[model samples]
Target: MDVSKDTPQAPATAAVPDDTPPEVSRRLRLITLVATFGGLLFGYDTGVINGALPYMTDDLGLTPVTEGMVTSSLLLGAALGAVTGGRLSDARGRRRTILTLAVLFFVGALGCTLAPTTAVMVVARFVLGLAVGGASVTVPVYLAEVSPAERRGALVTRNELMIVTGQLLAFTSNAIIAQVGGESGGVWRWMLVVATLPAVVLWFGMLVMPESPRWLASQSRFNDALEVLRQVRSRQRAEAELSEVSALAVKDEQEKLGGWQDIRSTPWVRRLMFVGFGIAVVQQITGVNTIMYYGTQILTDAGFAADSALTANIANGVISVLATFVGIWLLGRVKRRPMLMAGQAGTTVALLLIGVFSLVLPSGDGRAYAVLAMTVTFLAFQQGAISPVTWLMLSEIFPMRMRGFGMGVAAVVLWLTNFVIGLVFPSLVSGIGISSTFFLFVVAGVFSLTFVKLYVPETKGRTLESLEAELRARFS
Candidate 1:
């Protein structure tokens, strides 16, 4: 598809001309960087366990089933956190909600680092999961609402980039720290401790950041929202943007705003939620976490030594970060629906190949390398194509008034699906073996592709209000 090049001009305000001064752009970038620390924490907390788990199990004396529970409990907490956070952000405000989550992240990290038993670790991890879940829903929505439409895709996707980068940091740090503290009795505690640094940064950074202008408008705080827009937007543009957002907010209030009842009462919203749920489900069913949370174990199962597996897993983290960069670039240049479908296609083929390689390749040097190559290829497609687009679309598709709640509901499905996959993956691998587990992902990928091709709407180029009207008209 030919990409559109229309950069959204700043809304006309009294303090600036039609063209924004360079200082404004610089400030906006700074805001994006600070807010995205939430994503970094999200990634590190989820991925840190990949390396920490083996040591944790040894220290805590966990069984296989309990190990799965330990890994997935955080995900389950995330599922609840996503929905709760989304709703609270809508009712409260994005900045406040994130500030709250930052505290949770810090407390959760501390709890995990200090836990003395498996049961305590599970509870502590679940607390961390709440922050992760909240961040996944709140950060993207916060970024999208604050960003200019022209740079929206890139800016919103910056969070995804950071998320993968955080995961890479986790993996790299785990490797170095494990090697350095290898002889220490509580070595994994150090792995869990590393997350606290980002959490602290997120909290301090957000304290000075402005609240989402759109969110402010939703609460009828036009003056406060305008002040926020002025910080990152040119004065003229900020006033114009606030006016536009305010008009929509008024219309939404007049229409009685959002709830489950609102969704059920409105056919178009119900349909959009369904699409969102499908998008979330499809993203998870690819079995990405199987590789993420269990990549080291999978490598060991494929014949690599434990140390070799740890070293090799860094490749997975690196490729994920790189692929996310590609994905963010692609988001700016491609239609959302087609990009999603293409991602599904790429992941399907990669999963099929992974299954085939495991089934057909002989064990030893060639098999391990081949499987690793296919795993990297799968990450390239999955992270680059499917993952970023999924998050971006969820953040983009909802109406201003319902943005938080709608995205939250969709994210709830996403987190729950992730939870189920994370919970069952170890068992699945043990029960069905490697080849069949991947084959299962291949089947799910095909179904996901079909869902995107047939049902997912194209959402590029349109403003959030325009998209909502378009979807309402189409579905109505």
Candidate 2:
């Protein structure tokens, strides 16, 4: 295997196809789906908190500020977990790392459900955050490494699809449980407990799946890497991919791997990291989480009654899932940068309207409905365009040897940014009012759009190795 720019690389592996031997593709899809349970848990925990909060606050005796803290604690934990998880996955293997995270998710969810006070809840939520953050970084990278290039975008993005679907499930469950369990002393506990099911599923799921072949090869376990690849690929295809990947791994080893030094010394890698950071920031600044975490609140502020807001929030979840489907569809066909810019542009316009609607309409049903409409529209673009691109780009941009570390660091920035926004959104809304809060988002969206236009690279239609080479050439 001559590992050069001209080497004949194996075509990226496909998910087991429907028409192909059912034995192979069927097992592959099942493995992919099971591994992605991390994603479903990620969606459920984060989205469940949105509706569960009202009941939680009353039960736990929470103030507005404390309420924000409860919501953001997981995000804060995710920030640390994202970076640590990425590095751990890189140093360990993706399979082991995800399995560890599955345990964390189970423990954290159990803790949250059983928490007796706000303090306990926050700590427990932080633990959950760690799992979510880690999952955000690890799952996509694992999927990308395992998937064939032609189906890579779709397969990798299935995690995102699961993420939103998890959120929808959270919303639906919260609504149902709240409606049915109303007046129960701790109905919110039931909401939190639902997360445990997926966590258990994730742990068991990863037990049967192979580690990413790329990660294994990166660790110099060539035989083990080949065995894993052979399970998923035709023997010929497996050998070819192993040859190419092994060559890259050897080259990376020759260069010496790991740490802040690689990032500082390698200008191209550093530049890509900057772009990754910007993408992560851009995704958050669209105020999408504002909707995810506090959608009911936003609807209430706009004009809906408490019950109506909870119900209306479901619409947000529905649109998010649907938009993600569109996003996943677009991922294969569209260039990453353009899709991002379009998402930013659409979100920016939507945020501006949200501000205007809040300011112009008198406080009543009209104002509430108008703001709700804009939020939905904002999500249509933000979830459809910005989010999927951000995750896909982060997963795709890093070199194989440093994929976990690089993406983890980027996700740390993302989760921290989310934490900051989630922490302050209530205070900001209370102090400045909805108009100003949205205006701030509008400004952030502009900066995000500019960053994408100026720095982000197009990543579609190329192998990860080729993309790395192209980025190095352009940035170097």
Candidate 3:
């Protein structure tokens, strides 16, 4: 029952029939488009709050602490969702889990749209966070599973693209809505309801999509796995790939590499989880979400008028989308560890400049623009290198049987870290000032860079099965 775990000296490779049929390729593209709606939802739900919060604050009568609660509640919910969604996907099915999350997205959006008070909004945002956390773990894993190893990076990264794209859409929508409503009492409600359309789309689209072949194989449904593979892969390639996938699935079955028992009792798995935890921390510690959730405030604090800040914030969303596009291209051309380290270095430098500008410059347009420039630069590295690699590696590195479970646990760390930062960032800015707050992120970036060098493994140019085998051997 011992699977052929790939060793460093002898990594496995397949010389399969490379000609994926045109129809099959189209089907794969379609599947990717449909599944990534979860990601779009993730982006919109999280990003909308950045713009909506200003209006929401006034309407909901929020204090600074209550504002933090309103913002971090979804993140807290996301922390719960990461573990809950991962386990649910592992036990029930990724497709089913996403379906359930879609319903939550719709309900959560409706709740937020109609919320009469801060408490109701907090609860609604928490519900929405569940879907965000679920999609963060599930969509990439699902995309990675269905994609060809050769095209895995590009295809799976499409979800990352959609995420930023959704953010850009939110920013644009928020700006437009604000202008149209012109300081209306409930402009944020319009922002919250936009997410419901995508949620409905995700539910309907996933209904017809094929389940992950890897998931089917893990369940001992070899015939079903092969059938699903055949729909997306050429007949010869499907047969060849299924043999390797099924053998690994059987080996995993023998070892029961599916849950907390294996993660606790198996040394290799425990190490992998540790590395997974590091990866999760590395992504969050970059403080990328800080900009995403509060770019408007950051700009305003730097000296922009409130209305000016909201409009300028769209620039952050635009750059995020552009940076992610660059990240996807680099994933195909570069190794993961180097890209991640490079990203950390870039972000660290950007944070330093932001802090320096805020600390030294007078309250003028010059300093405001300087800080805005650095924030955009920070996102260039964050989205382009760290964010894509974090999600892609988490999706790639786990044993097939516990892919969802392992990634889920790691994502819990990610979401919880996000929750803490989201909750504290407002207070930090208020108490310590913008200059010192960014200095803290600069310090975190250094540690994150060191962790990547020492612990993170490269995952490019390898199939998930082969990578899993290689990781198992390395850890063991």
Candidate 4:
């Protein structure tokens, strides 16, 4: 595939069709709801820190470097977790891996809630990061595998919706908790503890959820795969879908398609991996997590009082949820490549404005509100377009046999990029001021936009099996 060459919109290839029974549709919706709780947890855990950090800084006596550590520790753990979780889901089945992650989520959250020392907090957050990273890989892959082709974009991106909703929940709760607790010594603990409830919900929910049908097929358990598929698809559609999935699964196994070795030796697979890595890096380098992990601090630096910033940060969370909703709807109607490029362009412009505003607007309500508005605009483009498309494309681009592993590796790159940004952002703001820091992101954004235009493929509107075949032929 000459990535620089344009990828035209693919004609929508219908999956099994809308002839599914009511019961089957209900089952599928239930599975999506349950599975996406992982995304909710992902959002809450990451976003809670945004509000928690200032309070934590007071209690822990955190230096800027330590604050960075406290925030980035989970991201570092996530980098490891992405690859480890990927392999685990591939070997142990997606449902079981998520079950284990839910347990980790509970334990890690509890640890964070009770931690008495900075060291303990970092380790605890790392543990949470592991679960977050695992969920990031497993949940979407699980959703992608089970969804019918026509509905796959909407279904898979539901996880993104949950992620932002989780963030919104964290922001809302953090504001409430901070307001109620005032300057109380341990208010951050309250913020951290709330995550435990959802972890419990996710565990119990997955206990009833079926394993990924494609995973079963990859394991050569065709009967089991078909049975699982039938829960969410009509019998005839289930049978037809299983035939296509199993054939690819068997071929993938014969070709030994599911490991690093295959990625290294196969020309097309290697090319796909390059694209996957690019996509992952592109998603992170836009500096979205800088806002997510540090939005409160950013607003404060921009001139809002700490209390006001905490409250105002809710707008970021709210817009993220709303934009993700729009992203989900748009995913159904737009081609992935163009949507992604448009998002990149929108966000780049937003970041540039934020930089310019922070630099020239002078300190006060005006600077604060301008920065806030720009952040909101940046997120609208991000959650609505860049994020959903990024995760959806990652879930779709890999081969069936190694879907989890491939996405995991790419996610590793994404988290590492995020980790670096989260770790450095506070210092960057303190060192050169907020304006220069955002200007840096603006430059990165321009590069990201060009990369997406030249390299990313259009992925919407194709069955996973057919998409894989097309990629193989195009790259070959």
- Give candidate 2 regions above 4 Å deviation: 1-20
Model 3 Cα lDDT, one tens digit per residue, 1-476: 22223235333334676687899989999999999999899999889989999999899999999999998999999988988998888888889999999999999999999999999999999999998898898899999999888788889989999999999899999999999998878989998899999999999999999999999989989899899999898888889888889989989989988889888899999988999999999999888899989889999989999888888888888999999999999998988888888999999999999999999999979988998999999999999998998999999989998999899999999999999999999999999998999999999999988888878877777778888877787779
The lDDT for every candidate, in the order shown, is: 0.86, 0.87, 0.90, 0.92
Return whichever of 1 and 3 wins on lDDT.
3
Minimum summed lDDT over a 10-residue window in model 2 is located at: 1-10
388-440 per-residue lDDT for model 2 (tens digits): 88888899988889999999999999999999999999999989998999999
What would you estimate as the lDDT of candidate 4? 0.92
Please provide, for model 1 over 160-265, each residue's C-alpha lDDT reduced to its tens digit, 9 standing for 90 to 100.
9998898899889988988998857889999999899988898999998989988989899999998888877777777777777788789889977678988989
TM-score of 1: 0.95
Residue 49 in model 4: lDDT: 95
> In lDDT terms, how accurate is model 3?
0.90
Better of 1 and 3 by TM-score: 3
The C-alpha stretches of model 3 lying farther than 4 A from their native spots are: 1-14
How much RMSD separates candidate 4 from the native structure?
Answer: 1.4
